[model samples]
Target chain A: MQTELSGQLGIERAVFGFTPFPAVAAAISRAGGFGVLGAVRYTAPDDLRRDLDWLDAHTGGRPYGLDVVMPAKKVEGVSEADVEAMIPEGHRRFVRDTLAAHGVPELADGEASGWRITGWMEQVARTQLDVALDYPIRLLANALGSPPADVVARAHDRDVLVAALAGSARHARKHQEAGIDIVVAQGYEAGGHTGEIATMVLTPEIVDAVDPLPVLAAGGIGSGRQVAAALTLGAQGVWLGSLWLTTTEADLHSSALTRKLLAAGSGDTVRSRALTGKPARQLRTAWTDAWDDPAGPGTLPMPLQGLLVAEALSRIQKYEAEPLLGTPVGQIVGRMTAERGVQEVLDDLTRGFEEAVDRINRIAGRSGPS
Target chain B: MQTELSGQLGIERAVFGFTPFPAVAAAISRAGGFGVLGAVRYTAPDDLRRDLDWLDAHTGGRPYGLDVVMPAKKVEGVSEADVEAMIPEGHRRFVRDTLAAHGVPELADGEASGWRITGWMEQVARTQLDVALDYPIRLLANALGSPPADVVARAHDRDVLVAALAGSARHARKHQEAGIDIVVAQGYEAGGHTGEIATMVLTPEIVDAVDPLPVLAAGGIGSGRQVAAALTLGAQGVWLGSLWLTTTEADLHSSALTRKLLAAGSGDTVRSRALTGKPARQLRTAWTDAWDDPAGPGTLPMPLQGLLVAEALSRIQKYEAEPLLGTPVGQIVGRMTAERGVQEVLDDLTRGFEEAVDRINRIAGRSGPS
Candidate 1:
C-alpha cells in the first residue's frame, strides 16, 4: 500500500529511512525511498544548515524529510545551566565513578566535546525548524510527540507534510487531532524512546485509531516480509531507524561501537532508562548494566539524565572503551550483520517485500483438500 | 504454508488454540482448528483422565492435542513442603501483607484453595502425561523446554508429535536437538511464560533456525491479520492462548477478572515475574503493581513465588477483590472487547485472514506511478 502520502510526495518505495547522518539520508532518498534525517544532533543551526546544503546537492532531486525532537509542552526560559543544576550530586558522582571504573580517560585537548540533548528543548527545536523550513524539505517529522501547534502550522506554511511518532493508539489519536499528516506507530522493539506495545499489536491499533491518515509501521521491522506484514496490518508503509545505523553511508564515529553492533543479536539489546532517562532500546553493555543495577542510584528524568552522562559517554567513545561504549538500537539488530550501502539495503527490502507478497498470494489461492 | 505436520495430523486450519478447558479445546477442534488443552491444572491423574474422556466424547472425531508443563531437567524428589520451605519468611510475610492491604478475605471453608505450580514438577507432569497418553492424542506440547529424551521416545513410540514452546532461536534449536517435532515461537507479548524477543522478530528467527520444522507463531497474536503476518514471517500456523481466555467457553470463575480483561487495552498488561518465577505477561493490576514496586520485598523464583502467593491469590479470587483479581493475558487483550463463541472466533480469523491476503495481493500488484 503506497499510501496517499507516498503519491502526494511522489516517492517510489513504501519504505521510510530515518537516520542522523545526511549522507545516509541522501543515499536512501536516491535509492527510491523517503529518507528522514534526525535533527536531535543538530544543536547548532550552522551544522544543520551545512548538512542540509550537502543533502540539497546530493539527493538527486528526490524528496527527503527532517525529524526533530520537539516535545509538545514547552519549558520556557530553561537554560542549560539551570537544567544541569537539577541533576543530583550523587548521579554526577555515579557517572564519574562509572567512567573511572571502566578505565576510560578524559577526551584529548581540542577534541570535540560530548553532545547534549538540549535540542529537545522547544526553543532549540524552533531554531532547527527555522533552518529546515528555509530548505525544500518535503516532510517535517517530530521524534517526540506532536510538534507544537504553531510549529505544525509553520511547516504547513512551508508546504511540508507533518508526521509524528506514537507508541500507542491513544497517542496516535492525539497526533491525528493535532493535524499530523501521518502517524509513525513506533513499538517496543524500536531503537529510541518507545512504549510497552510491540509492532504486531501497535501497528494495527494505530492504523485503525487514525483512519484515512497514513500510518508507517515502526519497530522490529528489517526485512521485506516485515514490510508486507506491516501493509497487511493496515499501515501504509514502514519507518526504519536502527536498520540504517550499519549502512556504509552512515557514520557512528566509533569503530568499536560499530563492531559491537555488528556482532550483537536480537537478545543482546535491552530497554533501559540509562540512556537519556527515557526507556530506549539500546545495545546492552556494561554501561547500561551498571545503571540498571539496583544498588546504583536510579536514573534521573529525561534532560537531566542526558546531561549527567554526556561527558562520561564521550570519554568512553574517545578512549574506545569497548565494554562501556554502546548505541541505541532495536531487536532488528540481529539481521544487520553486515555493513552494506544504503542502496543495497533498499534493494533487499523491495525484493523481500515482493517475495513475501508472492508467498501470501500463493497461500491465499490454495484450496486445501477436504 | 500448511506444514507437513498439518497434513499428517489431518488438521484443517493453520490455527492452534491453547486453552486449559477441555470444552473450549473440543469446540476449537470441532471448528476445524487444532485445540491443545493445557494440562497444568490437572494435578491429579484422574482429573486429566476425566477431561481426556470428555474431549474424546465431545470432539466429534476431530483430532486434538494435550500440552503438559514438564521442565526439561527433572528435579528429583522435591516435595511441595520442601519447595515451600525454600521460600523466605519475609516473602511469606509480604504476600500476607499484600492480601491484607487489599482487604482480601480468606477463602470460605471447603472452598478450592490456591494452586501451586507443583504441576510444573517433572513427576507430576509425568503422571499427567501418562493420563494423556491413554487417549488418542495426536500432539504433545511441552510448555517449558523440551521433554526428556525418554519422554520424546515414548511419545514417538505412540506416533504423537512432540512440540515445545521457545522464546528465542537459540532455544528453538535446542528443542530441535532434543527431538521436537514442532517449535512454538512464543514471544515477549505472550500471556504465560515468555521470552524477551517480540513475535515479529522471534517468529522469523525461529523459522530460519529450525528450517523444515513446523513452526507456530505465538504472542501478540489475536486477529486474522496477525495470523496472516505470522504466515508471512514463515510460521506454519498461529498459536494463541490469551485470546481464548475471554471466549464464551472459558471458565474464569471471577466475572470481575473477566470484565477487567475484556476492558483492558494493549498497554494494560506487563511482563512480570510477579505471576510466576519466570517472566510472564499478565493484566496490570494493584497486585502486579505492588509486586513490581521497589519498596516491597522482591518476588521469589518460580515454584517458590507460586507457592507463596497461591493462597493469597486464591483468597483474592474467592473474595472477588476487584483491584487484586487479574488473569494472565497477552497484549492482544486489547482486541478482545467481548465474549464470543469458539466457532465465531474461528470464523472471524479465517475471514480476516482472507481479507488480509487479498489486500496484500492488491498492494503487491500495484506498480506505482513513478
Candidate 2:
C-alpha cells in the first residue's frame, strides 16, 4: 500500500526497528521500506559514526533512521561511585552467586566495573544524536522518551522527522507536546521495554489522542496480515523489531540464532526487568527465571540495572550459553521460522498487504473471503 | 461486510459472550450475529435452563450458544469438603482480613459454603452441558480446555458446532485434534482467564495451526476495525465480551456502571489470580493490588483459590463497593465512552468494517489514505 508515508519515506508498509543487523536495514531500505539502526548498544559516538559511514556506503540512495534510548529520568548529577552505591549489597551478591551457579566465569576485578550505562540518560544519548545527525539519516527516534526539544528542532533543521515510542495515549500526548513527529505505539507483547496495554487497544487510542501526528503500530506484529491490521487500526506503517532476528543478514550470535530458529514460540518469551531496569519482553531463559524468583536479588532501577547485568550477559554470550542467553524478542517469534533474506521478508510483507487488501475488497462487496 | 459467517449467522460481525444481560444476547442475535451466554455463574443445571428459556423466548427464533468452563486439570475425586479443607488457613485469613479492612461486611457464617466451585471440573460442567443441549443451541463452547470426544460427537450428532477457547497454537492443535468445530483464539488482553501472548500474535498462530477449523478472534477486540483486523488475520468472525458491559441493555449495578464509564481505560486492568485460581484479566482495584503484593499470602490453586476469594467478592458486589469491585473486562475499555443499545453498537461495527475495507481498497490501488 503506497500511502503518504511511503511517498515521504519511499517505502512500503514495513518499518524495521533495531533488527540487530545494519546490513538488513540497508537491504530493507533498498527494498522500499524504512530501516532504522538501533543505537542503544553503540556505546560511543564513534561507534555510531562508523556504522553510519558503512551504511551510507552500502545503501544506494535510500533513506534510513537511527534509534537510541533517552529516558526522561536518570541518576542526575551523580558520580559513577554514587550510582554504584545506590545498588543494594543483596542485589550484587545475588548477581554474583547466580552467574557463578550457571558456570559463568567471574570478570577480572576492574572489568565488571567497566563503563557505567548512560543509555537512557539525555547526556549520553545526545552524543549519539550528534553523530546520528551527521549522517544522511531520514529520521531519529528516541526509544525510551520524547526527543529533547532542542534536538528535535535540530533534526527538523535537517528535514529529519523525530519519532518517539509511546506505551499509552498519555505518553503519546506527551510526545506530541514535546514535538515528536511520529509515535510508535509499542505494546505489551513487544521486545525491549513495553507498556502493559496490548497493541490492538493502544494503537487506536494513541491514533485518536494525537490525530495529526502519524502513528506506527508495533509489538506482536510480524506478518503481512498484521501489517494490514495495523494499517486498518489507523497506523501510518508497521514498526517491527523481533521479526528480523532470524533473517539471513541478522548479526546474531551462533547460539542465539540456533535457539531462536529451533526453540522459540509465541509463549517462550517473558517480560522481565532482569535484563534492563524496566520490564522488557525477552526470551524466557534460566537467567530471567532466576531473576524473577523470590530468593534472587530484586532488580535495580534504570542505568544501575544495566550496569549490573550487561557484563554477565556479555560473558554468557561469549560462551554461547544457550540456556542462559536471553535476547529481546516479541510473541511474533512463533512466526519467524527461517533465515530468509531481508528482501524476501519485505516481499512477503508487501504481498500480504496486497492480498489482505484484496480480501477486504471482497468483504466490502458483501461476498467475503474471496 | 456480509460473508459466509454473516450469511450463516445472518448478522453483522460481532459475537457477544457473557454480556451479563440475557436481553443483550437476544438483542445481539436479533441484530443478526450469534450470541453466546456465559454459563460460568450458572452453577445449577436448572439455572442455566431457566436463563436459556428466557433467551429463547426473547430471541425470536435467532440462534445462540452457551459457554461453560471445563478445565483439563481439576482436583479429581475430591469431595467439596475436602476441596474446601485444602485452602490454606493463611489464604483464608488474607481474604477475610483484607476485605474487612476495606469495610466490607463478612458473609454470615456458613453462607460462604453455598456452592462449591466445580467450574473447572467435568461433573458440574456436564450438567450445564446437558441443559444446554436440550435447547435449540447453535454452538457449545468450552471456555477452558479441550471438549471431551463424547461431547464433540454428541454435538456433531445434533448438527451443532463444538468450539473450544485456545490461548496458544498448541492448545489450538489440541482442539483440532479433538475434532473441535471451531477454535476461539482468546489473547491475554481479553477479560477472564487468558494466556500471556497478545491477540495480534496469537490469532494468526491459532489460525494457521488449525487451518480447516474456523477461528473467532477474541480479546482486546471491540470495534469494527478490530473485527476487520481479526478477519484479515484469518478469523471467521470476532468474539467479544468486555464491550457489552457498558451497553444500555446491560444489567450491571449502578455503581459499577458509573466506575466503568468514568474510570476505566486501556491501562486500568490487570491480569491477576485474585478472582480465579488462574490469572484472569479484570478491572484493577485495591483488591487486586493487595493480592498481588508480596507481603500478602500468595494465591491458591483453582477451586481452592475461588473458594477463598469469591465469597468476599460477591459480598462486595452486593454492597456495590465501587472502588473495590472489579469486573472482567478487556483493554478496549478505553474506547467505550458511552452507554448505547446493542443494535447501535452492532451498527457501528458494521460501518467500521465497511470503512476499513474501503481504506484497504484504496491502499491496494496505491493511491492511499483517500
Candidate 3:
C-alpha cells in the first residue's frame, strides 16, 4: 500500500490501533503494523515481564510499543494507603450498596480483586515503564500526559522513540516541547480519556504545531479510509484502539464484549466521568446511568474516582454482569460488529487503504464534484 | 485549484464552511464557493428578504443556498406560546440572576434578539423555510433533521436541491431514503448540535453507505489540510460553521468575536446544553459553567431551554459582555486567531489544498520516513 504511516513504521499499511493483549500485539506486528501493548492494567512486574517475553518469543523480532498511563498532573507523596484512607465512608457504602443491589456477591477472603494495581498513578506507571524497556520495544507511548524529560532521555538512550497522546494542538506542541518523538493527536471520539477536539481538525493542527515530529491520528480511526483521511490530515499514521476491542485476539471481559457487540449504534457511547474519573467515552450501561444520575454520588478526580470504582469493575467482571458491564470505546464501535483475527482485520485495512488511494487517484485531474 | 469539490460546485476550491452573514455568503460565492446563508436565526421574514436582496445585489449572479433548523425529532404540535409556558419559573429566575450578576443590561423594547427563531421545532423552522424558498436559493439544507417528504418533493419540483445533516451512517441512510440531495455528515466536534462520532470516522462511513449521493463533511473543518482530509474520507466537500465566526465579512456579535479571537486553544470550548437545550459545542463561559454546575438548576429541553436563555443572550449582546457571550463553535476555534476577508481565507484554503496534494504526490512510491 502507498502510505506515509506504513513508511514511518517500516511496515506495510495495516490496521494500526492499540490492543492490550500480548498475543494480539505480537500478531499485529507480525501482520505488518505496530502493535502496542497497554501495560497500565498490569499490577505485577512479573506479569508484564512474562507478557513481553511471550511477545518477544512470538513476534520473531518484529517491532512493537508499550503504553503506560502517565498523567502530567501528578500527585506527589501520596501512598496507596493514604489514597485508600481518603475514600469516604459514604462513597464506599455507595459502591458496596450498588454492587449488592445488582446481586453481585462479595469476593471470598484472600481472593484478589483490588483495583489499586491498575498502575494509573505515576509511581505505579514508573515500574511498568521499567518492565516495558526490558523488551525489544521500538516505542514507549504515554497515554494522558507528556513523558518526563528524564524518561524521554532514558527512552532515547535505549534508541526507543517516545510518543504521547494530545487532545489539542497546544497539547501536541507541549508534547513536542517535552521531547516526545511522536504525538498521537487523539480526538473526542476516541476510547479512554479524550479531548473535545475531533480528529479531522485536531490531527492537522497537531501536524502543523509539531512539524518534523510525526503525528499518529487517534480517536475515531479504524477503517482503511480513516487511515487515508489521517494521512490527508498530515498525520504519519492512524491509531486504532476501540476497533480492536472486538478482535478475536482481544482480552475483553465476556459481559463487556457482549454489550459492545449488541450496541445499538455509535450513539451508544457517552463521555462519562464515571470511568477512571476522566471524561472517557464508553458504551452506556446501567452502571454508568447510576453514576451519572443526579441522585447518585458524583465522581471524584482522577485516581480517586478510579480508585473508588475499581471494586465495582472487579465485581462486574467477577460476577459477569451483563447490563452493568461497560468498556472504553470510540463511536466506531458500531462497525466492530463481528469478531475477526488480527491478520484478517489488518488485511482488510491494507486493502481498504489501497482502494481509498486508488479512489483519490481516479479524481486527480477532476476539478470538483459531479 | 485542482480539487473534486470545486469541480462539482463549478467553481475553484475556495471557501467551504458556513455562511452566517449575507456579506460572507456573497463573498464566498465570489471567491469560488457555494455559500449557504443560515436563516434559522432570522425572526422576521423581512429581515431574511433584506439579506437575500443584499446577496443578490452583491453576488453578481453567483449561486448561493439557504439553511434552516429542521430537526428530525419533532415536537408533534406546539405553538410558540405553548413553548413559552413550558419554561419553568426556576429556570427563568436562574437565567435572570446569572445575567444580572454578569452586569448584562436588558435589550430595548421590541428590538429583535431571536433565540426563539433558532429552535428545532418543525413549526418554527417551517416558517423560516417559507421565507427561504421565496428567494432564488439553489440549495436548502436542514440543520438537525430529515426534511419532511412533502418539503423534499416540493424542493425537487422547483429544482432546488434539499440537503440534511447526519451525525451517523444510519442518519445518512435515512437522509438518502428521504430523498435528500446532499448529506452533510456532521461530526461530534462540530459547532451547533452534533453527534458523538468524529468526522474522521463518520464521514467515510456515511459516504460508503450512501454512495453517489454527495456527502459534505462538517464539524471541525476549516483549514486546507482538513478539506483534503474530508475528501480523503470520501466526502464530496466540507461544510464548516465555526471557521466563519472570525472572518471579516461574518456578522459575529462583537463580544463573541473577541472571545473567539482570544481563545487559547481547542480545550477552551465545551459541549454544553445550557444555551439551546441541545448539546451544542460552544466557547466555555460563566453561563455554561452555571448551567453545568450541580448547585444550579439543570437545563430544560429544546424550545424551553432556548426560551429561558433568550433574554440572557440578548442582555449579553446588548452590554457587549465578553465573559458571558458564547457562540456555537467547534474545536477548530483555536486556529481562528485572526480575522481576514473571505477572499484571503479562500486563497489560503485553495493554496493549502494544492500544497497538501503536492505533499501526497511526493509520498507516492516513497519507501520509509526520512
Candidate 4:
C-alpha cells in the first residue's frame, strides 16, 4: 500500500490514524503510521497549541497531521452565541424533556457543559490553522469540506500537504480542483458526518474520478484485511477514525461511552441527524432513538443542533446515563472488542495485512512468498 | 478463489452471477462462473420449468442455481388476491396519483399490469421449488429468508446445496443453523431488499459468524478487484446481481430503464421501501421520490407496497416514462457503462482480479508471479 503520499511524508506505514487526543496521535506516529489529530474539540486555540506542543515533544520528531472542521464558504460575523441563539426553543425543550425522561440529571452550576461550536466556525478554524502551522505539521486535513483556496496555498507554501474528506467522487473532484493534496474517501458507514456512498463503492469511484491524485479509503475499515481491501480497491492507503476511539491513549473521559462502543455490533449503529445536525453514524442509544422518533421534535441543522444537544449530552455523560450514552462511531465499532494500545493495534494491522496478502495470493493461484 | 463451494459446483471461477433471465444465467455458466437465476418472477411453474429446460440445453451441462423469494414461515391459505385486498385504498390512490402526475400512461384494455403477488406467496414458491428440484439444479438459494427445514432436507437429499442471503452476522448464523450450505452476505448497497450494513463491514462479520460454511460476498461488487477484496475478507466467492442487469443477455424490455441504469453513478441510487414492502436499493426516480416525500402517504410494508405500485411501474415501463422508469439496482450501477456480453464482463472480471492480486502482492513487498 506504500504510495507517493506515504513516501512524501516519510511514514513507515500507509495507515493514517485519526484521533482527537494528542497522546494517541503521538503514539500512532511513534508506531510508524501517520497520526492526525482532529482539531474540532479544541475550541480554545491555546488548548490546540498546548496539545501540539505536547505532540512535538512526545512524537520523537515523527511526522503527524492536524484535521480541522471548516466549511468552504465562510460564515463571517457569526459568533458562537449567535448560532446558539438561532436554535429553536422547541428543539431545546425536546432535548431537556428527553433527557429528564431518561432519568439524566442536570450538571453542577458553573460547570462547563462541553457546548463549543466555535471550532466549527471558519474564523475559529483559521485561528486553529494559525496555531497548527506554527508547529511542524506535515499534513492539514479538513473534515467538513474543502478549505479555502488561500488555506491550501498557505499549507502548500509551508510544504504541508492539504487533504480533505469527501463522501462522493464528485466531491473528490471538487477537492482535486481546489488543490487538495490527498482525498479521504469517507463512506456512509463512517463516524461523524458521512455521505451516502459506502467505502467499497466510493473508493474506486473517487480513485477513478481524481486520477493522478491519491485517495485514502475511509470508513468501516478496522482490520488489516480491510486495509488490504482498500488498497486493492485502488487506494494509496487507509484513513481510519473509529478504530482509535478505543485505544488506551484515547481521552474519551467516559467509561460508559467506551463500554457501549466496545459492546456495539455493526447492526448497533444508526445514521441519525440527532448529532451536529448532520447524518452521523453512532451507536444506537436513547439519544438517537428519541430524536429519530417521528413524534419527537426533529433535530436542527449543524451548529445549531450541536449547540442544542451539547448541554444535555454533557449531563448524560456526567451521570453515566446508561441508555442515553453514546459517541460518534462507525460500523467498524463492531470489531473493536478490546481496548489496546496504539502500538498493539498497529502490530495487529500489519500482521492482518500479511495474512490478507497471503490469502489473496493463494486465491489467485500463486504461491505465497517464502 | 476455487473454494469448496465453487469446486463442488464445478465452477471455473468463484464469481456467482445472479440474474432473472435464463439466457443470462446460462451464458454465465457457459462463461465458467456460477449462474443463479432469480425465480421470483417465475410466477407460473410451467414458465420456470421451461426456462430450466432451456438452461439445461444451453449451459452445456454446466451447473446453475435458482433463487426464490419465500418467507421462512408459511402464510397458509393466503392467496395473492387476499394480500391485494389487505392493501389500503389510500396507498392505491397514492400510486395512481404519483404515476398520473408523472405523465406515465396507463396500460390499454386487456393488457397485463405485471402485478403478480403469487410469486412471493409461500404456496407459489413451493410450487416453483418443486419445478426447480425436478431439474438438474446444483444450488437452491433463498432471497427472503431461510427455506423451511424440510425444504432444505429435500434439497440435501437430492445432492443440492441450500444458500440464503443474510444482511447480518446473526442472520448468517441463523441460516447456518437452518442447514444452509452457503450464506450470501448481501449488504445495504445491494439491489432489491437489503439490510443496513455495507459490504465492507458485513462481509467479514458474516464470514466469521458462519465459519466453515462458505460465505459469498454480495452488494457493491461489480469489478474483479472487489472480487479479490471479498476473497481477502474471507468470502469464498462474490455474488453479483446488478452487474448482470446491463449484460447483453439480460431481457430488460425497456431501453429507457437500461439507459438510466447505465448512466447512473454510485450516488444515484437510493434505498427505499417504495418498490416493495421491504427496503430495496433502486435507481432514484420520480416514483421513489414521491413515496419518500414527507408530505406523501409514505410506503406501506412489503407485499402491500409491491401490490400497490406494480401497475404504476408496469405503466411507466410500458410507456418508457422517462422520469418514472427505473429498476432495482445496487451502487455498482455506476460501473455499468455499456451493454456487453456476459462473457466480456466475466473476462474483464478475471483480468481485474489478476490486476488486484498483482497490485496487492506488490504492495505487500513481494514480487509478482513470473
Winner by DockQ = 4
Tens digits of per-residue lDDT for model 1 on A1-370?
Answer: 4555677888888889999999999999998899999998888899999999999889999999999999999787889899998998998889889888878887778876656677878888889999999999999999888888998898888889999999999999999989989999998988989999999999989888999899999999999988888888888889999999999898888888888989999999999999899899999999999999989998989988988888787788778899988888999999999999999999998888888876666566543221
In model 2, the runs with Cα more than 4 Å from the true position are: A73-76, A79-81, A106-117, A255-258, A366-370, B10-16, B72-77, B106-121, B366-370
lDDT by residue (tens digit), candidate 4, A1-370: 5667788889888999999889999999999999999998888888988889999999998999999998999776888888878987888788878888988888888999774656888888999999999989999999988889999999999999999999998889999999998999999888888999988999999998999999999998999889999999989999999999999999788998898888999989999998888898888898899999988888888878887888888888889899999888999999999999999999999899999898888778898662
Backbone clash count, each prediction separately: 1, 2, 10, 2
Candidate 2: residue B200 lDDT (0-100):
91
Report the Cα lDDT for residue B332, model 1.
Answer: 96
Top candidate by TM-score: 4
Clashing pairs for predicted structure model 3, backbone only: A17-A240, A367-B7, A368-B4, A368-B7, A368-B8, A369-B4, A369-B8, B17-B240, B18-B240, B72-B145
Q: Write the per-residue lDDT of candidate 3 for residues A112-191, one digit (tens) a residue.
A: 77445358888889898888888778889998889888889989999998999998777888898898888888888888
Ranking by DockQ: 4, 2, 1, 3
| lDDT of each residue in B1-370, candidate 2, tens digit only | 6556656656555454556568888988888777888877777788778889999998888888888887655556877678789888878888778877878876677664333455556778878888888898988888888988888898889988888999999999999999988899999999988999899999989988988778889998888888888888877788898888887887776657456654688899899988877999988888889888988887877777887776777787777666678777888888788888888988899888877776666665643334
Mark the regions of model 1 whose C-alpha exceeds 4 Å error after superposition: A366-370, B1-4, B366-370
Scored by TM against the true chain B, the candidates give 0.97, 0.93, 0.93, 0.98
lDDT digits (tens) for residues B130-166 of candidate 1? 8888899999999998889999999999999999999
Model 2 earns a TM-score of: 0.95
TM-scores for candidates 1 onward, in order:
0.97, 0.95, 0.92, 0.98
lDDT of candidate 3 over B1-370, digit per residue (tens):
4345456556655245567788988888887787888887777778788888898788778778888887766666677888798888988899888887888877878876745545356776777777777778788898877888888887888779888998888888988999988989888878888877888778877888899898888887778777776776787777877877788887666755565555646777888998788788888888899999989999998767887787778778667787877888888888788888888988787667656655554444422222
Q: In terms of lDDT, which candidate is stronger, 2 or 3?
A: 2
DockQ of each: 0.69, 0.74, 0.57, 0.78
| lDDT of candidates 1 onward, in order | 0.88, 0.80, 0.78, 0.89
Q: What TM-score does model 4 score on chain A? A: 0.98
Tens-digit per-residue lDDT, B203-231, candidate 4 = 99998899989999999899988888888
Q: Please name the candidate that would achieve the greatest lDDT relative to the true structure.
A: 4
